[model samples]
Target: MAAPPCDSSAHRAFDFWLGEWNVHTPDGKLAGTNRIVSEYNGCVLHERYDTGRGYSGESLNTYDAGRKVWHQTWVDTTGTLLLLEGGLRNGSMVLEGQTTGADAKLTRHRITWTPNSDGSVRQLWESSEGNGPWSVAFDGRYSRK
Candidate 1:
């Protein structure tokens, strides 16, 4: 029998991030906890993150066969919605998008998730304003819980 549609290696590119994790800042402060699970016959990855201080977010990630890219839709408690798309690059998943702030300023958001040799994952979020220099918004490391 043939393998399932979602069993392709492309669909499994994000498998390294599948698991419960303890997220910490570079300084070793506990930033939050996250849980990522594969679902929909491995066609989708669902992630839930909580800061344990009333801040939480969830995202659904999938690989678009037609677009040949990975997509992510994230929604947070603050009513922020982010739609990002990209694919594997340089051994990491890099996704980027643009959003307009309440002040009507255009902001570019880019996030990269890289798996480390120590079995940990590093996530870095950067933002730039209207072609300005990129600034780090968040940098966290994920270790299996």
Candidate 2:
């Protein structure tokens, strides 16, 4: 079968975010660096995150033809994996997914991608412990360098 078309701009919406960037927590604490490289083949985005705690993770994002949305799968060195699914909105790509299994906790996460007029992009990751409150966890700023 032929590959379906990815009509959603999400395939290119985050194009401005394809670069290296510094990350910070909501409290203004330095996190580390986040690097995103385009696969250049499909609507796929590769991600690498280095945290101040000496931890690192890699993620893969792609456009879902059936769902007509963008989704991301994250896996860290610690063997933790999360599948986040959502779509773009208001120029921001938002994704949210939860965990449930033998080694899973009910955690919800949302990622927002914002591109600025000055050629800078702000990507934010927020999580909620439950249905309680949403707290910003990761903030990544990328500038064309």
Candidate 3:
């Protein structure tokens, strides 16, 4: 027997980001590099990130059919872990999650990935605390490598 294809439209929502990329800050400063690959017959997106500063992380992203949402689990060398869940909205992949920081304070984290016309992707990560205004933690652009 052979495996069936994972060709659902929902599964391809994040396909635009599947590639090797050079991630940079909005002002064009090189921040890091990332490689996103489709695995398990497109059911999962695996990301490898390297910051060149002895830091690295990996994330596994997938779409949950029953929940109709995309989910991601990220773990970094610094022992930080984040789990985010959301769906594609307004042409961008947006995910939000809440976690308790090392200080034992609750925080909300949101990330959005937008595809640009020039074949690049923009990733914006923001955080908020206790209904406070969201602040950008990471704003980077991913250009094809």
Candidate 4:
């Protein structure tokens, strides 16, 4: 017998990230906390991140079976919404998207989550303006809290 569609490996590709994490900056200062849960029998991963300093966000992520790609929708307290799509690349879950800022300038965002051998996850967020150079927006390490 074959496994159900939702039980397939692709659907669980992001299982490594399902946990409560204490996120910290590279310099070792606490940046935030994150809680990720698997839902709908592995069809979706929901993420909530909070800095405990008035900035927080939540995202819904799912793997599009037909399109064979992963998609994420992120919304934050600042009234920002981002729709991103991508797949596993070089052992990382990289999702990129674009949005217009309040200044009406186009900005591109790329965020990557890579699980390290030490059981921590590294998240790197990069941004660029109108095809300009990409710069690091955020770099945080997540460990079990």
Instruction: Using lDDT, give the best candidate's number.
Output: 1
Q: Weakest 10 consecutive residues, lDDT, candidate 4?
A: 2-11
Residue-level lDDT tens digits of model 1 in 1-145: 9999888888999999999999999999999999999999999999999999999999999999887899999999999999999989999999999999899999999999999999999999999999999999999999999
RMSD of 3: 1.6
- Clash number for each model: 0, 0, 0, 0
Candidate 2 regions off by >4 Å? 1-10, 25-29, 101-104
Tens-place lDDT per residue, model 4, 25-121, is: 9999999999999888778899999999999999999999999899999999999999999989988999999999889999999999999999999
Q: By TM-score, how accurate is candidate 4?
A: 0.96
- By lDDT, the candidates rank as 1, 3, 4, 2
lDDT (tens digit, per residue) of candidate 2 on 36-64 = 98884756889998875869998899877
lDDT of 3 by residue, 56-86 (tens): 9999999998889999999999898899999
lDDT of 1: 0.96
Evaluate all candidate structures by whole-model CA lDDT and list the values in order: 0.96, 0.76, 0.94, 0.93
Model 4 deviation from the true structure expressed as Cα RMSD, one decimal place: 1.1
In model 3, what lDDT does residue 51 have?
95
Q: Assess the local accuracy of residue 59 in candidate 1 as a C-alpha lDDT between 0 and 100.
A: 99
How does model 3 fare in lDDT? 0.94
What lDDT score goes with residue 50 in model 4? Answer: 96
